[model samples]
Target chain A: MSQANEFWVVAEYKDGELQEVTLEMLGEARKLADKAGSLVGAVLMGEGVAALADPLAHYGADRVLLLDDALLAQYTTDAYTTALAELIQEQAPSLVLIGATANGKDLAPRLAARLRAGLATNCMTIKLGEGGALQMTRLDYGAQFQRTMVCSSTGTQLATIQPGVIGVGKPDTTRQAELTTVEVKLDPNKIRTKALGYLKPDPEKIDLTEADIIVSGGRGAGGPDRWPAIEELAAALGAAVGGSRVAMDLGLIPWKRMIGISGKSVAPKLYVAAGISGASHHTGGIRGAKLVIAINNDPAAPIFQSADLKVVADLREVLPATAKRLRDMAVSDEQGGQQ
Target chain B: MRIVVCAKHVLDTSIPFEIDEESKGLVEDGLVYILNPADRCAVEEAVRLKERQGSGEVIVMTLGPAPAQEVLRECLTLGADRALHLLDRAFDDSDAYSTGFALAHAIEPLECDLIFCGSQSLDEGCSQVGAVIAESLDLPQVSAVTQLELGATQGSVSLQRKLDRGGREVIECSLPAVLTIEAGINEPRYPSLPMFMEALHKEIQVVDLDALGVRSQEVGRRGALTKHIGLGPIRPRTKITYTPESDIDPIEALRLMMSGQTAPSGQQSGDILKGEPDYLAQQIIRFLQQNGMTPEANV
Candidate 1:
């Protein structure tokens, strides 16, 4: 178990850049590493990954495990899992955390199975338990209940942290890390899946996950007919528009725009819930927000309880006015600067 | 072509759930159970493929108690030709690893050309069962498939997988492969009237650990390498403090909401002209044009 004391984080890369979630994981891993009396390390695998080691070090990784190879460049389940499994056995980190992205979700389980370790997925928080074990708490039964889990056996404790759930810590830009290069042996016959091509989504599309402010509408927003006012407010705030599961279920918005446990998890600085009843299932998605404000006619709505500020007013009356006022304020500010 | 669709009955994710006091787990009381959303998508994809090929049989299989028949019935109603219910009291407490072993055993006798399952069940969302099942059977598997199309040959299929970093990848695999369907693969079809009635009377073959020659010691809670130690409530504190009133009435309310100290600032403020669709549309169109954009043609 002494080998397990070191903290390891898997860094995910996209378009020659480190994904934000990778930084978030490193930020959390730094805390765990400090508590475990060890150093934080990262497993960097992919094409052109050597450039990522410096940024990882800047983000507080004491060491970077670099697996650089063309076969390792593109993510294939068989290839990635085989390589990671071998690394786990060799390094034997006490705690391994992966971002609960699509790749992480796919890879974590296979690695856990190979190591015969316990896994907790989509965890909200992770900390060192008594005796230096990992304690993980995740929303269960659709965010209605929370379950705390720990690895009962020896070896590595594995968890996939949900994106936008943890805070991105301050990176120490002056830190230096040791980059250890390793070779992963791959069997051609074992590689059954092959990547044919990559498709990129349209850049103009709004990704709420990256939005600094989100304007979400619910059933009380009436219908698709009322979306213009909501869009106006979103435009005024330079925010992304989101919808509750009820709105998505009722076809008010596309399911991709739904924000909840089944959908995307977002952690914008400001979150505005309009016409939303504030169901626990839905609130779980926004709990990571720096601030939450709820607007609904029913003052007794459950969402108000979770909100930092509540407006007992109709959304139809308030949204456009707020948009106009914010616009006016922006214009005045610009004019004053010119004067 | 023979297709095997693995399904699991899970608590509907849309509703609030409680933990059962007796079981020390999720409370099933008043909770509606349905075919896991991902699994439904998988079954629907298989049904569509079979329909396209014009000659294939879809078999639905689940490992749970009799109540899980409801999930199998859902698949049958959606056009599965037959169903297999791997029912046994002993299988109740199986973890992902044990579940994988049991499923692999059950799938061995069927000799399926393709096995499909949801990417992950909503309850545990472990996202490992399909891959583990593939490992147990020593077959190739792909997870989180957003799109699937049959290739030039009968035994090959092309797939588009949802990648973690906001992109998709196209992959090709031969037949006798396992594929887990992601959400938004295709809209799952509703059960037809006649199929629903027929599903009620269908004789779903029940298999046990012994029937599949799986040792009792290899499954259930005992075989599970991990167990639940405790559960906790996630309670985030919400403290509200109103701003001091020093402004006029109209802007005062707005100021109160945006003060940051009192309320989180993004809550929906209603459109000023409430309940007037044409007026709202006119306002929206004007706003768009003012911003050098035209209203969407359809809208």
Candidate 2:
């Protein structure tokens, strides 16, 4: 295994930090490359990202290529694509892996097109098959079925891996790699897209995937009045608030807070359901939770069948009571600790 | 100005799916179809641009079998001026690469000033064709555009792209580019009765690989750069065990649970509280108070 015969992971940087997906991809790439009897390399871009190469090597990259330039600091399609596509051409690696972030999604297809290469986007898994052919598995039709794609043997294989699906490899501080800087000649006039500024969302909103505990509401939550109670419970329990697909579809909540087959899949420590009927689609998402406690008006609601604890009570009453209970318990625990 | 919106007629994913015994792919028989939700957003955006300009032609296009004409017709009813249907059996099993190749070739002669597409179709969710077509046509593209504003002359597109990391990036690009729209860009309007009727009789220009000057080998699965290998089940990482306490009083169970007292072994069916509302409420309060989950009231 050598640099020319290695699999490449395109390192992604944001807010002066290497994105976790980039490390996760490197770990995955290491596995595939090892299976193929190849090595792993990484491509880093941005004005001051050269130092980011060491961590990439620790994660698994055997070699790191840096394109540090002021023009490359912020990601614009043309400049990055031109530079990366050129590198791919020069290196002609067997496979290239990129994170399926907004930037990666925009970059992968364009690069694939330039090289006439096969691309698989939002892949959950990648493996090396017989004769070292690249195989990828991705969710299709909103996870209704999994499609395994085999990259064509013609050119370099490209794939954008979904974030959070692959586990990050433990960093080996002892590992080191050779770092190389590549020069890119970018014509300012050829750059068609100009980024103006970034707009940040309200910081209070929690991403469901990152939450350890979740309090979710569904159609059975009644209406907007019950939403506050759900939020209150979540706050008391130090949990994030989520909604079922019906709650989101009816405009009761935003799409990002939705959880189900078509929405974000979560594996929280504790998943407390309020007034949810528990459609199979919803259950499909929460099956990974460590524990499921469901409260609904109907004892026989489908959610009960899947729950470890089933409480048949009106959510409007049970939610507030549960919140009050958790709050009191926390206060007493604090008092006992002081003594 | 000419705006072309690429619409996809996809199998309704909400329903059940079965693998075809013969093709080993999705079963097509008895399957319901609809315009992809994201593509609907693209069509709506195209129509809005056309209406705003009030002097441009908006064309809705799709490359699929005969049934795909329905999606184009739906777009026509949404106010697109015409439609382009790339219909042929040779178009079957096409991957995003060849599909983009075919579309880029078909659209080249049309000389479109702007091209719109859904971020990704639900069936495959690859989210690739727009960028591929843009690359094939050598145009710059913006993907997952949530907000779009055209310059006064419609020469450039200023867009806000939603990032996965808690913010949005505003980017400006020259026209004659591709823009793939996500949902929430616009609410697609329902077709009025008169417009719906007019759209049915409207002509759709159908083209095949021969007509589009694409070689047969370069249009379908033969033209694809990737192939579907097989399918497998998505396994859950954790398993749930029940803690049945239906026989125990809820208050007792709550006290036992909070005290970290172990329930007897072989616990299975979980707790099921049943009583009148007032009684249940009182019992719950007692349980909470005993578990130190509620404040000690005027007992």
Candidate number of the best TM-score: 2
How many clashes in each candidate? 12, 5
TM-score of candidate 2 relative to the true fold: 0.75
- Candidate 2 lDDT score at position A117: 90
Cα-based lDDT at residue A164, candidate 1: 64
Q: Hey, what RMSD does candidate 1 come out at?
A: 9.2
> Per-residue lDDT tens digits of candidate 2, residues B1-299?
89989989988889987876556577667888899999999988988887887889888889998989989989999988999999888989899998988898888998998999899887888888999899999898999999988864458988999787446888888989999999778999989999999998888999987899978888789899899988655542221122344356878767766754324321214567765544554555454345333423311
Q: How do the residues A55-158 of candidate 2 rate in per-residue lDDT, one tens digit apiece?
A: 88898998999998888989988889999999999988989999999899999988888888999999888877777787788888768777788976476899
lDDT for residue B98 in candidate 1, whole number 0-100 = 72
Off by over 4 Å in 1: A1-4, A203-339, B13-16, B20-23, B164-166, B236-299
Q: What is the interface RMSD of candidate 2, in Å?
A: 8.3
Candidate 1 residue lDDT tens string, B1-299: 88999999998878876666666676656878888998989889889989998998999999887899888888888888888888787887877767777887899889998899898888777777787777777677778998999866677889888875346788987778889899778999977788789877776788877787887877777566556666646753222222233233766566655753233332223222233434443454344344323212101
Candidate 2: residue A210 Cα off by (Å): 9.1
- DockQ score for candidate 1: 0.24
iRMS of each prediction: 8.7, 8.3
**DockQ, structure candidate 2:** 0.29
Using all chains and alpha carbons, the TM-scores for the candidates as numbered come to: 0.73, 0.75
